[model samples]
Target chain A: MRKFAALLYKDLLLLVRDKAGLLFLFAMPMVLVLVMTGIQDGAVENSSKKTVSVLILDKDRDEMGREIISELQRQDLFDVTLADSTQTASEVQQAVKEGSFLIGVYIPENISSMVRNEIESSLSEMLGLGSTPQTDTLSSLKVFIDPTVNNTFRTTMMCYLREASNHIEKKALLSTISETAQEFSPFPTDSMAPPPDLKPISIDEIAYSKDAFRTNINVTEHNVPAWTLFAIFFIVISLSGGIIKERQDGSFSRLMAMTCPYSTYLMSKIVVYECVCVLQFLLVMMMGKLLFPLVGLPVFSMHGAFALCLMIVFFCALAAIGIGLTLGTFASTHQQASVLGAVTVVVLSAVGGIWVPTFLMPPFLKAVSVLSPLNWGIEAFYNVILRDGGIRSVLPNCLLLLALTVACTAVSIVAKKKI
Target chain B: MATTILRIEKLRKTYPNGNKEVLTGLDLTIGQGEIYGFLGPNGAGKTTTVNILAGLLKQDSGNIEIFGKPVASDRKNTMRRVGFVPQSIAIYPELTAYENLSVFGSVYGISRPELTNRIGKLLDLFGLEKFRDKKAASFSGGMKRSLNLMVGILHNPDLLILDEPTVGIDVQSKVVILEYLKTLNSHGTTILYTSHDMEEAEHLCTRVGIIDGGKLVAADSPEALARRFPECHDLKSVYLELTGKELRTMED
Candidate 1:
């Protein structure tokens, strides 16, 4: 026991003296959290109020073409632009290709003539006057609508065109049919197929109201806090180098010569590393509370949040130390130990939802996350911060983390024996 | 003999590569209150013999008895009576001199109060009291050597094993270390020392063993070995006459 205390004291002294290393271990994570939050928050805000540009090619000089262009301008959904005659199809295609225009519409010529022909044909058919007239004028008129427009925009424009065509056709038919009826000396104008009467149709458009889709969730509130927990866990792996150093320096052999059991030495290391990790976790949390609010996250009751954080920190530290011990036992040099430790932490953290949200990952990847202790840590953080969970809510994650810690420690002990 | 503190019989160590034998049927016994000097040129297996005795390396076949108990049978029990100061500086540089001594003392199961007292005495004995608070990193080569020896003796084991304890220190520091070891031996502590300096070995060792090619060529008092050799007038002459003037270098 006295020997164990000595070991602990020695480790603490080494840590204290390494001021630069300590600062990096404790401060770097908080700095990363702050920087990451700022960037992500800005990006999310910018994406919510997205803008789409559109190019319009008006070929028809008629009133119908002008009305269509005006209708597009009245709607706020698109930033509309009129392309001049010199701006050929190639230029419009290039703009669309370059992503400058969300879409492009080309109005064809003779659209007015097609509308007049449709009115004459409909009135003549209704009055049974002259044989049914067929000429292909309507087909030419259909070409005036841009075929490249998206379905939503195209439908709106078609609706407007149809309304205008109905009004023009009705007025032309009413005047021509009534004048013919009077010249033919009819008993009443109604006798000539009701004088090809025109009826008015009501057109109503209900514009959709745009809602503010962007919310004010702070960067730290989303995932940075969880990543901070993961970073602390990674630092625990660096402590494995201490064990390798002891072994290389012959201190381990010297201690063994002093009648101390190998088990005692390993346990002492685990205890010291766990303590360091817990301290780091607490420091990061305090920094978060002081700094997170400055970045715009809502400040809530820190008591429950800190409690959940501590529980996760404890389990993560235990597991990380166990991993460190396992690596230390097998490594022959400090470099090898550091490499293995870093690789293990990175792979685990990546799978554990530290880098990518588990929700965004595929099912298999999410299933693989169960193998990572970091997953439980981040999940615990999410429960506290996002779900506003208390101890009862985070209990399962806490239990799993604890179980993992025990399992890793056991595995480390076994590996140490083999070494 | 005054109670044999360390006894080894038919110690054998063979490397796995080419089945090369490093220690071939060697045997020796060390008595209490005696300074036993193990001498050999480089690659003469002096370090291997010391390592085997210190329990740092396991021997292929050997029977080691420390304080009349078999070290091979129960190493932990036997190791409690022994303290090892390796040829290299094994103390932590990041820790202060006092802290290093305290840690090493505690490893032998010394209590907190006893460790504090032991550490203070060791620092004072090595003349490191003034620099006790400073880290070992700041210490000069000789200071580190002194602290290293101090840490090894902090627990006051029955047998202190030192491998080249004064290899790299200044003359003054070497004298201090040798005098300290002699003082400890006079107080009934057994010592096993390894060195290549013939003059120091002749002056300090009560029984000197000359080993060459992993074989014990001669074992006796330095005067006896000199007297036995016809042309030898000093320990160096005896060593040169027996082992020959050859530069021994290890291949692997």
Candidate 2:
């Protein structure tokens, strides 16, 4: 055990001196979390483009056009304004050109007559009563815009036109069918009166609740914290270069010549790597708490967050040590071990959702994620932070991580013997 | 019957590729505190012999007894009493000389106080006390070699096995190392050294064994080998007379 302590001390000393490994394992991941979280918040905020002002020119005085105007006003995306009849193509163009409004819609004077004609034509075609429908009612609703408005305005206009066309079609169908049917003499006048204005569908605008809040929280909040946990594991794999260095240098054989057993040396490595990983985990979590809120995540409870983080760090440390042992056994040189170590970590992290979200992945990829420790770690973080889950909720992931640690450690020991 | 520090009998090793025989029916013995030199041309099986004795490589057929205990029966205990300084620089270059010594000493199960004392003594002996805090990587070839040797001896094993210890060092470094080995010998440590330097073997070894074609050609005190070859005055002449001057190179 004393011998192992010495070995562990030496490994820690080497790790302190190797700046490249330190940066790759600890600093780089922290930086990545900061950058990724910032970008994610930016994307979410950009997607929610609040209120857009719309100019409306209603040439038709019919009730259908009036109904369409009222409907446009109801949607929160648009702030609709009616334009006078005197407003010409140039005047409307100037208003859009001056950037007073984001979009403009001009309803033609013959719109109601056009709807009537379209319904008749469609009925004639379906009944084989006349030739095919003549007018393109759907095509005429297209708005002419100042091309400078670009695709955003074009897309919004297309959406608006589509909604209007649907309403027109429904209203026309009701009018046409009722004209052909008998008058509604069976129902009493009081009974025929329209039902009291049904309340508008109440949409809860609350982006998050205390219980379901985590799902609505931006990726930066969950991903950065989770990545910090992953970074600690990565550090373990990276620092394993010390073992390979000792082996290549013949220092390990020389050590074997002494009273120390292979078990002591191997155990020391596991201990030192676990310590480093845990340290990294704590540092990054602290940094996340301090820095990530600027990217839009709410302040999280530190006690539960850290407790979950510690469990992940422990698991990662074991995995790292196991990987180091495996590499030490198989690698002929420090360079070989370092390269393989780096490659394994990168590939594992990619599959584990460190680089990408598992939810966005295909079903097969999600299933494949089960094989990676990162998936369990992220799941654990989600439960803790999003679900407000306590120890019981995270217990399953913690157990799996512990199992991985044991399995990896056993394989590492067996591999060490072979070496 | 003075307790034999090392004993090998009927040791045979064959490479799987090309059916090459590296060692065939080799037998030898060394008593305590003896500086035994194993001399051979390249590929005469000097390294293979050392590797087998060190338990780093398993021999196909052999019986090795160290301190009256069968090597295979209790390999770990046998290894503990032996220190091997390999041909390569086994110390981590990134570590300081003192740090390397401490790690190696710890691996040997030395107590902290003992390790601290051993490191200081080794640094002073190797004339590396001033560079104790400097990383081994920045040291010259000779300094690195000296530190490497120091790391091997930090545990103070009873039997020290050095494989080409002076292979790639300057004359000054080699002299310091050889002088240190002599000091260790005077303190009753048994040493088995392998080297191609005939003069070094003549000066340092109490007895020298010349091997050729994986077989022992001569085994006796350096003076005895020289006296037996009437035409030979120096150890080099004795070596050439026995193993021939032809270069032996193997195709891997």
Candidate 3:
């Protein structure tokens, strides 16, 4: 016990003395959290809660075109605006192309008349009357979308516009049919009010997890855990460099020659570095919860699962330390350890959904992401913070992280024997 | 003979992925209270022999007994009686001189009071008292070497192994280190030293063992080896006559 304490004390002293290293360890993650959340929050709002700007170039000066614009505004997804009268079709295209508005609708002149004529001709043919000749001019609604918009949002806006136009056409056709029936029938059409057109099926969205609390995945919630895990895993560079230095300087050999087993030195490193990892996590989390709101970002919350969230962080630290030990044991020099450790951490972060969310990745990448320890860490964090899940929910991810720690530590020990 | 402090019979080693054996059937013994100079050229299996005794390595085939207990069976307890000063400066540069000694002393299981006393005594003995609170990184090369030697002897092990402990230092520092080894020997500590400097070994070692090709070629006092090779005037001449003048390079 005394020997272990001595070893631990020595390592902690070294860490404390390296003021630059300590500052970088804590500050870099905080900066990443703030910068990443600030950048991603705008994107999150644009895709979900924030309204998309839509421009209307209504040339028809008719009821149909007006009704479509009104319908678009009524929906919560779009903020409709009237385009300048002097703006030509080319001007409208340039505006949309420049991303002044996410979408632009061009309602051609006489669109209402064209629809009515088509309806009359169809009705005349159906009633066995002689059909009127079709008009030579063709008028249709044209939509202009900004090229920069993501495909998913573009598809959604297109679907909504199509549905709005179709609904208006159906209403006009129904009114025409009703008027024709009133003219031919003996009974008055207004004797009794018609029932409202209520659809037979409606959809209600429910929370997918056990908790009924449906939360938005704001940037704060997403970035805090991701950057924290990144900072934690990046400890490999420092830890591995320390190991290589010890080996090169002969401190490792001197300790090995002593009666104190080399395992004590390794255990001391694990204990100290793991604590540093946890401290890094807490610092970044505090930055998100306290400092983010000051910068106009959402406050990061764990959904009241603080204890469970910390458990995941602890497991994440172990996994990180395991990798550091393995890297330090195998790498022959400080440069090799540092370069390889940094590259490995970056690759892991890339595949683990730290830089990009897994849901947005392709299926193959998402499948590969599950193999990364960072992915397991972020998933566990999401379960507790985003999904409002319980211990049972995060158990699988935590267990996987624990397994990684065991495998890496085992490999490090075997490698240390060879060293 | 005095009690055998360390004994090795038929020790052999070949590193993994290595084409040649580093040590082949090497045999040696050192008695208590003897300053034995184990001499060899570069890659003559000198450091390899010391590393095996220090338990930093395992022999492929050998019988090693330290203090009458098999080293293979009881490495932990056996190593408690050994101290190794590597050729390189091994002390942590970031740590203060006092802190370095305190740490190694504590790990050697010395009590806090005893450790403080020993650290103070060592700092004074090595003329490092003024730099005790300073970081080792700021020390000159000679001071760093002294601190390295001080760390090895912090626990005052029964068998002290020095591998070129004074190499690359000024003559004054070298003399101080060589003189300290004599003082340590007079206090009944068995010493196994390896170095390329022949004059220092001749003046310091009670007995000298000249090894080549993983085998000891001559074992006697320096005076006797010089007399046996009548044409050689000193230990260096005797060493050259026995080992040869051609430059040799081997890696362990």
* B158-185: candidate 1 lDDT, tens digit per residue: 9999999999779999999999999999
Model 1: DockQ vs. true structure: 0.52
- The residue-level lDDT of candidate 1 at B243 comes to 85
Where does model 1 sit among the CAPRI classes? medium
lDDT tens digits by residue: candidate 3, B132-192: 9999999988999999999989888899999988889999888888899999999988998
Q: Every model's DockQ, to 2 decimals?
A: 0.52, 0.60, 0.81
Error of 2 at A340 (Å): 3.9
TM-score of chain A of 3: 0.85
Q: What is the TM-score of chain B alone in each candidate?
A: 0.97, 0.97, 0.97
Question: Which scores higher on TM-score, 1 or 2?
Answer: 2
Clashes of 1: 1
> What is the DockQ ranking, best to worst?
3, 2, 1
Q: Would you estimate the TM-scores of all the predictions?
A: 0.77, 0.83, 0.92
**What is the RMSD of candidate 3?**
3.1
Q: What Cα-based lDDT does every candidate model obtain?
A: 0.75, 0.75, 0.86
The TM-score between candidate 1 and the true structure equals 0.77
Fraction of real interface contacts that model 2 preserves: 0.75
lDDT of 2 by residue, A1-419 (tens): 67667878877887778888777767876787777766765766665666667788877767556866887888776788889977754566667778887677777677777787788677667656566447765425435565665465468667767766666666676665444232444654444443233333677655432454333755655666567756755654464566667776677766665535777777877777777777776666666777657656544344346676577567656666666676666776777776777787777777778777787789988789878777777777767666667778778877887787677667766766554
Ranking by TM-score: 3, 2, 1
